[model samples]
Target: EPEVTQTPSHQVTQMGQEVILRCVPISNHLYFYWYRQILGQKVEFLVSFYNNEISEKSEIFDDQFSVERPDGSNFTLKIRSTKLEDSAMYFCASSGGLVVFQETQYFGPGTRLLVL
Candidate 1:
């Protein structure tokens, strides 16, 4: 079995700085996504990518945020400018198929971002 992995499990940065969260999804998966959860809050979808382009995204994925798969196996999320309110646990996920039953997304442990 394979699994998604994230790097730098935790990160701290000053407001206005740029940050990049990295993830490696299970081999052979086709869809990739990013989601965030504030402490005590429900997980919120950020963006979804497939076929090398953005398939869908939420309002939260404003100009300040971007995502890329620089390498076929690694996906990354970049925040242009960090804000105190942007602090949250970011998760990277991937799904191999879209069937109702197999469309489940497997998530990485998460990368905690703290902005000051």
Candidate 2:
């Protein structure tokens, strides 16, 4: 399986600032997702996109968060405003398909964001 890859392995930003995280999902993937894991928390889903639109999103993905597919192979996650609690490792993932109810997703190395 092709792996998802994220850019800017680490980032430090001030509270209230905006950050755009870049990702390249698997070439043939039909599903994309963004997830975050705070310092000591379990991974939490932020949003899922399919067919050029968001299919599902968690409460954590409020107005402050947005996702976009700018081209055939790139997907991005933008944080409109950063907060202290937003510090975490953001991971981009891609799954082959959704036909079987569940698909194995591969995650990127993750982009670590630190809000100060």
Q: lDDT of each prediction vs. the true structure?
A: 0.95, 0.95
Error of 1 at 36 (Å): 0.3
Candidate 1 C-alpha lDDT tens digits along 1-116: 78899987999999999999999998888999999999999999999999899999999999999999999899999999999999999999999865624688999999999999
Tell me model 2's lDDT, rounded to 2 decimals.
0.95
lDDT of 2 by residue, 53-75 (tens): 99999999999999999999999
Model 1: per-residue Cα lDDT at residue 55: 91
Model 2, runs deviating above 4 Å:
98-100
Candidate 1 positional error at 63, Å: 0.4
Clashes of each: 0, 0
Q: Relative to the unseen true structure, what is the C-alpha lDDT of residue 34 in candidate 1, on a scale of 0 to 100?
A: 98
What 10-residue stretch in candidate 1 is worst by lDDT? 95-104
